[model samples]
Target: MALMTIPLIIFLFPLAYSPGPGNMFFAANGARFGFKSTLKANIGYHIATFIVTYLLGIGFGVGVSYSPTLMLIIRYVGVLYVVYIAWGLIRAGITKRNQSAKHASFIDGVVLLVLNPKAYIIIALMFSQFQPSTIDPQFYFIIGWISAVFTLNNMIAFFFWTVLGDKIVGLFRDKTKAHILNFILGSMLLVVAAWMAYN
Candidate 1:
């Protein structure tokens, strides 16, 4: 198990650290509402990630197979959700003071995970690569360990992106520059949404 740690980290690094929807969502929220304010959403997301990944590791694929169109529905819904969040940020950027802007909630984080097809795909891929072919006494233990590691890796990546967003905005003392940052982040989210929809 110890020997698997390095390889697991290496396999997950790009997937977790890349500017995907989850990382971008946290970064945008962090830029708009600071790291402390985004903590609830952070916790919610990782919690869901761990739960969903563990379930999938332990034979949730049968359920998914029974619902053939479920993933398709999730993909489109996720696209719309991302677009909605991006529009909010874009609108906020247009205003001098976004008095109406609120930090993402715990529910929002859970919904995002529920709708995100990419997340499910990643979890499936992780199990495919790491899970043993035959079930044994250690199967449950291995699955739990993988799920925990996957959640921890994602948590760290999201935290880094969140802090990066906060620090980037902090570097600019001017409000206009801050607004520009919001626009950039929001636009990047739109791109991610498009990618999710088409791919």
Candidate 2:
């Protein structure tokens, strides 16, 4: 178990930092609204991530995925949500670039994390690597503790992605360049949505 720590950190860091739906979502928000405005949503996202990770680590995750009917429903709902978000991002970029509209609300952050399929798979794989053949009395405690650590890392990754997007926009302050940035971000969102639907 002790030897697993290093490998786990290495595995998780890249996975958390990678450009997935969550990272892209934050990046888009920061590009649209700046880091200061996105902080609360970031907090909400991490809170949701922690809760979902904890739930999966403890046991409920298995039951939820075991039912094919329920899993199918979740899959379709998630796909629709991704599409909706992609559409909204594109619309915002094209029509509301000059306005200070809220691109992603706090509740939106929470809901996105909860519904994100990649998040669940990552949490599941993380625990699977650590679980022993037999249940130990201290298992849940360890799981909770490790999940807190993972959540912290997750939050940090989100901050970097958000800041990166914010700074990128700051560099291109001209209207045309800013619009180009928005188009790129919106395009990335569309690609993510398509990827989610395909996978």
Candidate 3:
């Protein structure tokens, strides 16, 4: 249990920090609506993330990781959802419309993370690498610790991206630059969606 810390951080930090679907979604929302306004979504997203990670760590994720058919279905659904989000971003950008009125709500964020295949994959991988076994005397303790750490790491990652996007909005005061930034963010979402489909 003591030996797992370094490996866990090494494995999770990059994935959490990288421009994945979840991070990008939050960042995009932060840009559209200020970070303060997006806190509701952030809270919802991280709560779901924490709960899902806890379940996965405690041996409840077996069905997800082993079922290839379920994973395939999830992948396609996730791809479609991500594409839909990308389209929204692109539309908002192209129209130069401040979409604060129609931005994602707390429930939307919860649903997005719950359906995201990448979130499940990341949790499953974290559990697998940690090898949480019932036979181990410290199973529950270890799982709790790991879940807490993972959730904390994710919280930091989410905050960083959200703030970065919030700052970016100020920088891109020009309509054309703002439009270009939105397009780039939308493209990043599409790329992540593609990765989800193939990987």
Per-residue alpha-carbon lDDT of model 2 for 45-150, expressed as tens digits?
A: 8898888888878787787646767666666677678777667766653323344676566788898887777787788788888654566997877777778878
**Tens digit of lDDT per residue, candidate 3, span 1-199?**
5578878989999989988888998888778676877787777887888878887777687777679998898888989999999987876643223554676678877888877888888888788778565647787778878888888888899889989888878777677887887788888899989998999
lDDT (10s digit) by residue, model 1, range 134-182? 8999999989999999999999999999998777767644767766777
Cα lDDT computed for each candidate against the true fold: 0.83, 0.77, 0.81
Ranking by lDDT: 1, 3, 2
Most accurate candidate by lDDT: 1
- List ranges where model 2 is wrong by over 4 Å: 1-4, 93-100
Off by over 4 Å in 3: 1-3, 93-100
All candidates' TM-scores? 0.91, 0.87, 0.88
Candidate 2 root-mean-square deviation in Å: 2.5
- Indicate the residue-level lDDT of 163 in model 1: 93
